[model samples]
Target: MHPFVSVVIPAKNEQGNIGLLIKEISEVLHALGNIQFEVVLVNDGSKDNTVIEAKEFAAQSQCQLQVISHEASCGQSTALHTGIFHAKGEWIVTSDADGQNDPADIPALLQAAQQVQTEHFCIAGFRNKRLDTPWVRLQSKIANGIRQRFLNDGVPDSGCGLKVFPKRTFQALPYFDHMHRFLPALIKRINGKIVVCPVNHRNRAVGQSNYTAWSRAWVGVVDMFGVMWLRKRTKLPRIISEEIE
Candidate 1:
């Protein structure tokens, strides 16, 4: 069966969380009733048993689950790219492997995407109340302020893992190391609409964060400048009409 939506999750060492995350996703998608959904879990060279746990859950899962593995650890952006590229669904939903992004919010994002008139669009989740350390939150705030001022993509939380967009829109964007963080800006560069939806955020139940605030900020600053350059050079043509004889 062809899925209407595919949830792509990137995990490195999330053995404890992978099974639970997939179960939650299955429950949520099953409740939607009319929607046909699948889960694509990309195991990014996990040292732990992340793949094993995911496969165990997939055996009993009502939803279709596909597990892809990377021989070596690539970054989250590349794992996301791999999952989305292989996904069968037209609509792709991204979630973190840490189980912080709530599965219940997926329906709302899909609904928002459906409401958009244009085919090229993105629905980014806005985490109004983050459940993280004060220091981490502060760092994120500073980074977001800098990003917003420069990109002006009008997305409040581009870092939020819960996002809904079409696979075609994502494929059209240029692939980069940290392109995942600048999705809103990239979508805008391609003349796509951005919609921000308020979603639930939770503290991590298990496993440490793969990246620190400092690490993210450092790479983010560089990637932000790169996106700015791409934005400046981007020129979208306006086609008036097409005639087929």
Candidate 2:
């Protein structure tokens, strides 16, 4: 049997884009055919009508659509956590709900994950072909370069908004603010082999990003330093004894 795939979307103020995103996923992939899938949308306290439209989409979608809302606006990492927690599918696929991450590219990621026996664990996505503002792209390049130099992890595009992973893998990783940025490296820490493929990136159609360019740059400083701290603090668990607590 094909493993169930959960399509997790993180939305802030994407009222216009959320409905379209759901429709696209249903048409392209998430319709319940040979494989089972679910669309889990985490509305991070959008001031717009995002939640209402998302709920309507859930009512009609062929794939079970679930809407989770945050009482107040939290970061994207929190939204990620909420979606993953609600995901019942064995394989979890996360994408940006701002229309930047194409639903059509999901098949490619799924195929790559399955090829590598992803039932155990794997995070797959694009290494190149990212579409965004020149400044956004440049910022990502500098951030990724710094991460690669410090972490020595060979993730090409860690900032790409599209990723596929086994739900179990997510269960194993430690949670941190902006942890989404270091998914590839975190996966490696738990002995997971992260895979990369080319995924289509589209321009934003609706709401603007919640984060500013300068804040993104500043967060990189904190995140990089924190990651370095984690590297030092990590200790391998030893099998002391098999006694129940």
Candidate 3:
């Protein structure tokens, strides 16, 4: 049977977390035996044993599991796009590899999707109180504020990696570097709805973060303006009356 949901996780040098994360995801999804699901772990050119660990767990996973590798380190957006492109499931869910994103919250996102009764919309997680350093949280807050004001996507925590969306909807979007950070806005550009649900945020217990608040904030500044431009030029027609001749 084909998977109903494809969980795509982007990992870069997350050897310590990949195995545990996969185990947690398997356990959580296995409990929900009614639904068919697959976990796709994208190894974003990690210079560690991440690929090995993932492959080991994939071999023993009860549900379908796939591990995709990149020859060089691409950004998170590219890794996610690679996994999404290869995903066979109708629904796509993404999460971080640092083990901060709880696998238990996946069902809630699924429930939200069912409750809304739409596959074209996105169900994103809102980390009410992030388990990061105070400075990190402050950076996120400022970045989110600026993004919300400019894109008006109405997403409070756009940086949360946990998001549930339809695979087709994601594939339809114009792909670019750092696009992962602006998914809600890009989805909105196509007139897709955004639903934010409060999700658990855990402290990173293992590897150090690949990103820094200063670097992300700086890059985000540039990406935000580009998104604003895309939003301005977007023309999603309210009415379409196309007929084949």
Candidate 4:
């Protein structure tokens, strides 16, 4: 039987966090009671023992687990693409492997998505109180402000990795490098609804983050303009009625 939801996590050199995060995910999903779910862990070519640790924990996990690996380190977007495309679930929930995104909040995201009446929608997590360094928080604040102004995506914390949406809705979006960062905007461009939900955030207790503030800022600048172009050119017709013979 296919899983109802698949929690896709992209990890690189997150050995200390992967196993623990998987365990937490399993526990939370099991508590949902009769909600079939699986964890699709995409090891983004980690030089560490992330894959090994994940497999070890999967042995005792209550929910199903699938691990995919890239021969070399691909970016988070590519890892997410790999996992989501391979996931067997109808709904896809993505979370950071750093353990900052609480697995317990998965229920909240799922509940938010369930309440949405639209067939195509995205539930983006809003971190009201970020637990990052002051400098990093400032960078995010500025970047988010600019992105909102340009894309008008209405997502306060688009960088937050915790998001819930249907697998089909995600598959409909055009994929590109760093596409993960602009999900809300892309979804909106394609005429999909966007829902924002507040979720818990925690400080990293394990490995360091892969990308620095400067790196994110530079890439975000280029990606933001690219998305703006895509939005302007995208023309979705409003179908008043459709009848299939």
Candidate 5:
């Protein structure tokens, strides 16, 4: 039988962090009990031993686990897209491989998603106490403010890596580079609601940061404008009538 949930992690040169994150996720899910889940780890051309570590964990994991590899480094958006494409679960849970997002919060997201009556919606994690450098936090704050103002996504922290959503809902959205950062906005464009939940955040215990302030500013500006354009051009019908059987 197919799993009920698929947790997708996009790892790029995260050899030190991937294994522990995966193991934590497994333990949390197992403790929750009675929920069949699978872990989909995407190795986005990591130079380190990420693949080896992931494979080793998968071998010993109680729940099903699969690893997908990219020959060259693709952006996070592409890596996530690949993982979603190959996932065989009704619900998709995504988190970064850097261990900043706590695996313990997965149950909260799942519970929120389940308790809501709305079917086509997502539960996104919001880090109340972010564990990042002050400068990085400032940049994120400014960017998030701009995104919320322009896109009206109603999500305060779109940059949060932890989210739980239906697989089909994600499949309906248009794909693009850096699309992961714009999920709340994009999901809103499709007339879907997003529920933001406060989740635990931790400092990265291993590896260095992959993104710098300048690089984030440069690409974030471009992507912000592009997403704004998409939002402006998006048109969803208020109501649809169909023949009843």
Candidate 6:
């Protein structure tokens, strides 16, 4: 049997981009013709036609597709959890539903993960040239730097929103509001490894960005501390409570 990969996309209101992204991903993966893949789209309370568009795409695609819905807008992290939990593949890859992450870059990420020779390793896409606004870029750079400095993970683009991990490992992550932004550190808490690959990024063709500068700063403040707490609170087990003679 071919190794299965699940492509998970979390969308809030990305009607314009989701359809094109779906087509592009299908084309690129079909050309590869080696790995079997499925797509799991998480529609996180979209008030737009996003779900309708995704359903249409699913109906037409040769690759298996499924949509998970959230009645209310929880957040991207929650949507990610929903998608991964629904995924039926050995490997899980997540990309922004807004079309910023290009499908052409996935092969490099998968190849890098293979080279590391560890099932515990995650493949992260480090944007070669970020297409987000300057302010968003600054916040991302700051968050990643702070995480790397304190967490020793050396991940420079934790907020890139393009990554791949074993479905089992990803599902094991502790839940949080913005866990998507700190996957590298969360993985490290359990001694997991991550590999970074420079990936292509494109400017959004439609739909306003879901993140705002102020919201980012506020959330960053809380998430940074939360990660620190997780780091400090984690303890290695040193004893066996019982042994059979």
Worst 10 residues of 3 by lDDT: 112-121
How well does candidate 2 score on lDDT at residue 105?
85
lDDT of 1 by residue, 1-245 (tens): 22399999999999888898899999988887888888999989899999888888877776698889999989999999999998989999999999999999988888888888887889999999999889988888888999999999998887899999999999999999989999989998888999999999987888898877788899999999999999998888999999999
lDDT tens digits, residue span 1-245, model 3: 32399999999999888888888898898888788888998989999999888778866776588889999889899999999999878989999999999999998888888766554689999999788888888888888988888888989998899999999899878899999999988987887889999999998878799977788889899998998888888886665686878
Candidate 3 ranges with C-alpha deviation above 4 Å: 1-3, 240-245
In candidate 5, stretches whose alpha carbon ends up further than 4 angstroms from where it belongs are 1-3, 238-240
Model 6, span 124-239: residue lDDT tens: 88886887778778877776677677766767887788898888778667888888878887887766788888999898889787877678667877887898889889875867
Could you report the Cα RMSD, in angstroms, for every candidate shown?
A: 1.6, 2.8, 1.8, 1.7, 1.9, 2.4
* TM-score of each model, paired residue for residue: 0.97, 0.90, 0.95, 0.96, 0.94, 0.91
TM-score of 6: 0.91
Weakest 10 consecutive residues of candidate 4 by summed lDDT: 1-10
Instruction: Give Cα-based local distance difference scores for all models.
Output: 0.91, 0.80, 0.88, 0.91, 0.88, 0.83
Give a tens-digit lDDT track for model 2, residues 1-245. 45898989989989888888888888777443578888999989888999888777766765588788899888888899989999999888999888888888887788778777433455556647666778888988888788889886567777777888888988888888888878777777766777777878788887788888778778877887887777777776868779777
| Cα shift from native, residue 121, model 3 (Å) | 0.8
Which scores higher on lDDT, 3 or 6? 3
State model 1's lDDT.
0.91
In model 1, where is the ten-residue run with the lowest total lDDT?
Answer: 1-10
* lDDT (Cα, tens digit) per residue for candidate 5, span 1-245: 22399999999999878888888999999887778889999989888999898878767776588889999989899999999999988999999999999999999899888876665788999998998889888988998888777778888888789999999999989999999988888888887888999999998879887767678777988998898998889887766677779
Regions of model 6 farther than 4 Å from truth: 237-245
Q: Point out the higher-scoring one by TM-score: 2 or 3.
A: 3
Worst 10 residues of 6 by lDDT: 112-121
Clashing pairs in 3: none
Clash numbers, per candidate = 0, 0, 0, 0, 0, 0
